[model samples]
Target: MDKQIYDEMIENLYWAFPLLKTKLVKPFDKEEKEKENDLTGTHMTILFMVKEKGSICISEIGKHLGICKANLTPLVQKLIDKSYIERFVDDKDRRYTFIKLTSVGEDFLDNKRYKVQEFLKQKVSDLSEADLMTLSASVAGLREILMKIK
Candidate 1:
């Protein structure tokens, strides 16, 4: 493939990420939130990542999200304050700290995920099995490509 074509593909993919996330994911997440303390999409993403990874250092989280420690610190602190995450100094290394989702965090993720799953289930119920398989494969391919990029 030509370099220009690859560049355009990358650009388009970058732009489409936010659109797809907002259109498909955000509505369900926002639906159950209280008006005063609604979580932003970025916060929910960080929470989800931490929950999935079990425990991770701030540096690793920053690297994965293409953010800096200075930027991530406040967000992590906010989650800590909300009791969704806990930070602790590593036993082996005093200088290093790890962040993990608390039980509350896990509950939040499960509830929000249930909402998203229900939405998807209803939307995809009428899709042909072959079409569903195709989408699953395509998403796996996309994840592989993204992993390589990282």
Candidate 2:
């Protein structure tokens, strides 16, 4: 790729960042904020991680999330208070604290997932079928290109 072309692509990415965030992210953020629950985005991410991992240690969750244990503690505690998660000591080890989602946590995650899915579906409903296909193709091509990059 020509250096100038690559530079222009970088510039376009910078230009696109704010527009994409405003168009796609801000509305969702606003909607989520209006909900009765007060789970921050990071909290939701941790809940999903716990769901996917089945049960995970706080230390391990921190590692996966790039959060240090000190910062991770309060978030985990808040979830515990909400009954969204539970902490237990390992039966064999006894020293390790493992966290897992409560039924409430699972339901909470499901609700959030459905909302985002519906929101995205509604947002794209106005796009023509051909435009949708083009968007999908462009996204796939970009993914393939990124994978081939260092």
Candidate 3:
């Protein structure tokens, strides 16, 4: 892409960040409030990551989320306290610990998944088939480009 186009894209991204965050944060906050849960956005993100990846080590989770170990330690501890996840020592390597979702965590995730699906369906149902397809393709392309970065 040309420099001007690239600059414009970057500028647009900067402007879109807050709007995107607001779009995500509001629903999540509402859901949490409805459930009477105190989980923060970061905590919910960690749960979602674990749900997506199944079992993962703390270091791996931190790396995947672009967070450092020091920052993730307390977050993992909080999840453990909430009984949403469990940390177990690797049988073969005592030095490594793997984190996995507990049954409660899985249930929570299932509920969240349903809510998200329902929300998306309601929000996008009015779009034409072609528009939906274009949006899907655009999202896939964006994911590919993001994966290539860093």
Q: Compared with the true structure, what per-residue lDDT tens digits does model 1 show for residues 55-106?
A: 9888888888898888989888989998999999999988988999999988
Evaluate all candidate structures by whole-model CA lDDT and list the values in order.
Answer: 0.83, 0.89, 0.85
Better of 1 and 2 by lDDT: 2
Query: Residue-wise lDDT of candidate 2 within 1-150, one digit each (tens)?
Result: 899998999998788779768987789889878876688888988898999999998888888789998999999999999999999999999878999999998998898889888998888899999999997897798789889987
Q: Over the stretch 1-150, how does candidate 3's per-residue lDDT look in tens digits? A: 699999998997897678666775576568668988777878888898888888888888888789899999999999999889999998998988889999999988788779878877776799999999997897798789889998
RMSD of each: 3.2, 2.7, 2.5
> Would you estimate the TM-scores of all the predictions?
0.74, 0.81, 0.79
lDDT of 3 at 1: 67
Q: What TM-score should be assigned to candidate 1? A: 0.74
Name the best candidate (by TM-score): 2
Candidate 2, residue 113: the lDDT equals: 88
Q: After superposition, how far is residue 143 of candidate 1 from its true place, in Å?
A: 2.1
